[model samples]
Target: MKKNKTMVEIWQDVVEIKDLIRSIILSFIFTFGVYLFVSPNNKAKELFFGLVGAVMGFVITNVFIKPKRIIIFDKNKIKE
Candidate 1:
């Protein structure tokens, strides 16, 4: 008999730690860039919102983004 897999089980394989980390880092960089452009005069506000942006970025990417899959098809093969 085969066992049924739950949604969580299926998703566990799809979610990756590296991707999460990358997303968080990217968010930090983006937030910093925006901060520089906006020139927030308060250091406390900058630090606090940067942290928030990082966490939000991680969660959003993890929940909504999936790794891309690449597939190659060859049409030149001949059947004997």
Candidate 2:
């Protein structure tokens, strides 16, 4: 039997389950790693660092993964 690819629509955008899971795992690892490795004495510091790590992960995913789009141009739609 052939397996079908799973896709979900989020905010009117389509996303693959595999990609979503991978992104989640990467973000979780980065967020926790930074939070735990940094000084544990201050709660505020840890929270701030964790947020930074999450942002870093977001950037990493955006940089590494690209969105798929097929854009078509219609001459009739163009106004000169």
Candidate 1 residue-wise lDDT, 1-80, digit = tens: 23442222234454345555667677777567655654467989787767666666666676765664446888887889
Backbone N/Cα/C clashes per model: 0, 0
> What are the runs in model 2 whose C-alpha is more than 4 Å off?
1-4, 68-80
Task: List clashing residue pairs in candidate 1.
Answer: none
Candidate 2's TM-score reads 0.71
Error of 2 at 36 (Å): 0.9
Give per-model TM-scores.
0.38, 0.71
Error of 2 at 38 (Å): 2.1
> What is the C-alpha local distance difference test score of candidate 2?
0.78
